[model samples]
Target: MLTAERDELMRIIRQLSYEQREVTLASGRKSDFYFDGKQTTLHPRGALLVGKAFYAALRQFPAPVQGVGGLTLGADPIATATALVSALEGQPLPAFIIRKEPKGHGTGQWLEGRKNVPPGSRVVIVEDVVTTGGSSMKAIERAREEGLEVLGVITLVDRQEGGAEFFAANDMPFVAIFTKAEVVG
Candidate 1:
């Protein structure tokens, strides 16, 4: 369900992230319209709205989610904001980050914040946007490798591309706050 917060986030996203022009996406797909979710995810009010929406999603999840995380860079702010919101909501969920590559030094783990969450703890993967679903899939795989059980995937926006199909084929529960049509059309 899109609540008031979710609706406001959509408005902000449309105003900040939506663009029309020929451009290539991270998935290497060319499109006339693009959504750079970071523009909104990184904004002050945008982050707050995203946090509330994600936290609400977590609370409504069928199973308990011990942590929230996704591929770094894009997912970092989303996961962090959600965790902060959860804390404000009094549940205080821990947020983790899944690095694209292991850190260059130290433990060199591909995942972070695991120390705060126990092994085998259930977690939900969050993403700024979904196109081919590759990024979200990578995050889920990494989380599992780190001994975290993935409960589902949540994205700030879905391009209405093959992402949804990919997640469905892989049987990964997926949710998007807004679709391409909603933002672009």
Candidate 2:
């Protein structure tokens, strides 16, 4: 059965509208579809639903995550919202942001927000959407390099297109609030 939180999540996602047409994805591929996850993920109600759903999803894991974060731009709001709601719920999961490239000057850090987690600290990576899984995987790599024990990945939308399978083949647990068909159809 869908919980109240999940139902709310669906309601918010279903309310999003989009135009159908060929467009290039971040992965640089042409397709007859496109999704602006930010439209839903950044909306007031959408943010609340995403935050609550993310928290609930994390509960299914074996260990508590020390933090939740992801690549910049796309993943920023989702991470922040999750962190905020987690705190309100008293669980207080911290959030972090991963830069696409290291800053050129002053500290030259790649990951921002909070300090580097202690080695083996469990962390969950968030993404607004997963197409080829490149950005999410890159975040995972950076997290691992920073000594984080990546628990898995959570995304607002999964484009299908082998993203889930790719993560699974590599032993990364992947979960999403909605799939391409769920949103597009």
Candidate 3:
């Protein structure tokens, strides 16, 4: 269900984050257009839209979605937004963060918020943008290592590159709200 807020968020994301320039991406590829989802997902309006949209997307998952999260930095804000929105919706989905590496001190955990997201819980991984799907895959690996079942993956923007194919090949359900074409056109 695309609410009015979701539509407006898409428009704002294009206005704020979509850029056209020759630049190397995290995937080590040059692209004509880039989507900096953090710019939009971090905004108040954008955050609300992302939460609402991602929450809705989670409902379509084949299995129950107990929580949501992804790799740190990019997925951090997104997971928070979705969890907040889920709370507003009265379901209250917990948000978890996957560290790139285990913390060096203390418990040296690779995942934070484990108190809420127990093992065996089903979770959905999120990303601000997907290029080669490397980051999201890493998050999935971390989550599985923690004994979490990844229900699916949802991204804000899909570069329309190899991400979809990668997820498909891995047999993981994937969804993206917008594509580079939709944002740049």
TM-score for all predictions? 0.94, 0.91, 0.95
- Clash count, candidate 2: 0
Q: What lDDT would each prediction earn against the true structure?
A: 0.88, 0.83, 0.91
* Model 3 agreement with the true structure over 39-116: per-residue lDDT tens digits: 998888899898888988897797578989999989999999999988998999999999999999998999999999
Candidate 1 lDDT score at position 172: 90
Return the candidate ranking by TM-score, descending.
3, 1, 2
Better of 1 and 3 by lDDT: 3
Better of 1 and 3 by TM-score: 3
What tens-digit string does per-residue lDDT give for candidate 1 at 1-185? 25676778888999999888899888788899878889999999999999988887776567678899899999999999999988987898899999999999998888888787778899999998899999899888888888888988998898888999999999999988778888766
Pairwise TM-score winner, candidates 2 and 3: 3
Q: Tens digit of lDDT per residue, candidate 2, span 1-185? A: 14776666666665663447789888899888666778877888888878887887788667768889999988888888889889999988888998999999998988887563566779999998899898899999998998788989999888898889889989999998778787656
Per TM-score, the best of the predicted structures is 3
Model 1 residue runs over 4 Å out of place are none
Error of 3 at 66 (Å): 0.7
Local error of candidate 1 at residue 69 (angstroms): 0.5
Which residue runs does candidate 2 get wrong by more than 4 Å?
1-5
At residue 37, give the lDDT of candidate 3: 86
Q: Candidate 3: how many backbone clashes?
A: 0
